[model samples]
Target chain A: MKDRSGSVLRLAQPVRLWVQRFTFLLLLATAAGLMLLGKADTVIVERIRVEMTDAVAPVLDALSRPIGVANDLIEHGRNVYGLALENRTLREENARLMQWQAVARQLEAENAVLRNLTGFVPETAATEVSARVIGASGGAYVRSVLVAAGARHGVRKGQAAVAGAGLAGRVTEVGDRSARVLLITDLNSRIPVVVESSRDQAILAGDNSDRPRLDYLRANARVSPGDRVVTSGIGGIFPPGIPVGVVVGTDGGLRVQPPIDWDRLEFLRLVDFGLGGPLRGQGGAGDPGGRP
Target chain B: MTPAGGTIAHRVDAAAREATPAVLTLVLILLDVVPLRLPEFAVITPSFALMSVYYWTMYRAELMPAPVVLALGVFQDIVGGGPLGVGAFVLLATHGAVLTQRRVLMRRPFAVGWVGFVGVALAAFTLTWVIMAVLHLALFNPLAAGMQYVMTVALYPPVAWLLLAVHRSWVQAR
Candidate 1:
């Protein structure tokens, strides 16, 4: 009986190894197949991605609060040392800003009169929803952030995510309680922008770099360093004249230096301009006009 | 204690033992996706989940099987917001490759295992870069990939030590 059992066990051992190997191969192939499926059927893939992100959004949200606080504390500690110098600089800037405020008010009054004379119809009222960034794409390939607000908070796809003093990115995916913002630095991101000074139209294209490059500029667009780039609003995805970045390099390749301090991007103000065009109401994966 | 109660406790303990590795791996994955908020930290975030997989697969292959690795990879991909299934493919390949080397790796010293992990991580990152490039139809800047590889290799010791401590205390206690 012992000999027979031993032989049986010996036979089962090889079979078990075969089963394990087969299972491993099957799973590996399944993973590869999923990648193809994700590319072929992006709508289904996006739905799954958003659901998965939404499920963990709360856990990530709770986990990130302490880290945010810790970072703030560190910044505060460093700021204490530079407080006096910062105060002087801020005071000077405040004085300058006060002068600018006066100019802005005058411009507003003059613009209103000009608009009334031209019978210009104003755009719809814009709305803002402030959201905390809960997660980020830690991998180098994707530059995106998961904000704590979602469709439930009136955060829709194609809304502009502004951080600090410039446009950060646009909303690509929105779940029940979480949304994903594709930053301007992502390789997949493209924005129609105009040179604020020259009014030359160009496409701001990202190559997974901190500084996105300008593409498709006219040969004699007269673009130079220190020129500002703003949304053209031609596509109607974003409102016109939103600050994007400034041209920092015009040699070899044009690079725009966005004002956003990405490291300190803890919060975002998602702005909705009530403009819907070619890129609206579709999964941003198949965006034809570089809407998001 | 009642005999039935003792049996229930035994089953619960066995279940917990089986779950420990997966739970630890999931936690590391969540850590991988958490926003570090440091300058350029996102681009070079180490593969913390890979360390967990390597540690468990090296020591306890039964608990850290290919299916579990695939599931964990999918979760990481969905949460990390990268191209879907890329993470799953890379991790599944890592598990298969490491399984064949398990015998040799097990017999070697900790430092040897660390060296093995360097090769595994390099191969994994290269695979990811290639797959991403293909999907995007453009070559990604290899600078970020190189930085991530270095960061993952530099971070292995502490993560491996932590996994080892967990293995010794909770996994092997019974």
Candidate 2:
């Protein structure tokens, strides 16, 4: 009886290993299958993205706090060290800016008079939903940031996310308490913009670089380096005239330098410009930011 | 205690033991998402998720089985905003390569095992870059992906140390 039991036990070992290996292969196959299915751009895959972001929002928020504080401290230290030089530079900049302020005021008054004669309906003022940036997925494949604000906080997909400097990204995947913003420099980003000085219109397309290329410009568009680029608002997603980038030329073509630095992003103001953002359904009752 | 009670307790213990590697891997992936203060860390921080999976599979493959590794890969694809299944397919390939040589690696010293990892990582990263280009339907600057692979291989030693320490503390007894 003992000899028979020993033989049985020996046989069971290999059998268990084989079963486990088989199961592993099966699961791997299933995972690959899901990936192929995801390429269909179905609602189900989007739902999965939203649900998973919701589940992990709180955890990411809690973890990002210290990192944000650390960044602030470093910035403060640098500021104090350069206080003297900064004061002189700021004084010069302030004087220059005052002249621009006077010019702007005069232009505003003229614009108002022109609008009154033209019976132009002014665009609605944008409402801001402020939130901390908790996670940023940066790589060659993706350039996206996750903010603490979400569907629960009146944020919806396609709403523009802006920093103090300029336009940062647009909300792509929104959960209950978190939303993912695809930065302008991501591999898949495409935005319609016009040059501030020349008024030359073009499409800004990201190629996973710090500077995104300006594509489809008219031949001899007369665009120059250092010209400002702002949203054209042709898609009705972003508000018109929001600053996007500055023009820079390379050997290949013109590229735009994004106003906001990727490393310096801590907080974002998700703007509801009332342009009828995409994915406006479900949750956050009575939020009019997304309704058409 | 009744016999049934003892069996239940044993079952719980077994489940927890099986889950240790999964929890570790998940934590590593979470760390990858946070924007820490280190320069060039965001894009080029060595692939923490990949290293953790490789290490656990080397020492304790049973605990960090294929299904759990598969889930980690899909989670990466979702969070990182890449084409789905790319990570899953690549990771499984690495794990399979490791499994074929696990016995030899276990018998050899750490240096030999590191060399083995170098081989598998090269193949995995090449496959990943090719898949990414195909998915995006355009050729991207290869420098970024190449730098990422180099950083991942170089940081393996220190990260493996941390993982080893955690494993000894939280899981050695279990």
Chain B TM-scores of the candidates:
0.95, 0.87
Write one digit per residue (lDDT tens) for candidate 1, span A181-237: 999988988899999999999998988888899999999889989999999987677
Candidate 2, residues A1-292: lDDT per residue as tens digits?
0223346648886666677678867877886687667666566777887788778878888888888888889889999999999999999999999999999999999999999999999887888899898887755677888888988799987888898878888887788898888888887788889998888889988887878999999998999889999998765667779999899999989999888777767889999987755645322123354545
lDDT of 1 at B116: 96
Badly placed stretches (over 4 Å) of model 2 are A1-22, A279-292, B1-14, B37-39
True contacts kept of each: 0.77, 0.54
Docking class of 2: medium
* Candidate number with greatest TM-score: 1
Total clashing pairs for each candidate: 0, 0
For model 1, state the Cα shift of residue B149 in Å.
1.0
TM-score for the first chain in candidate 1 comes to 0.92
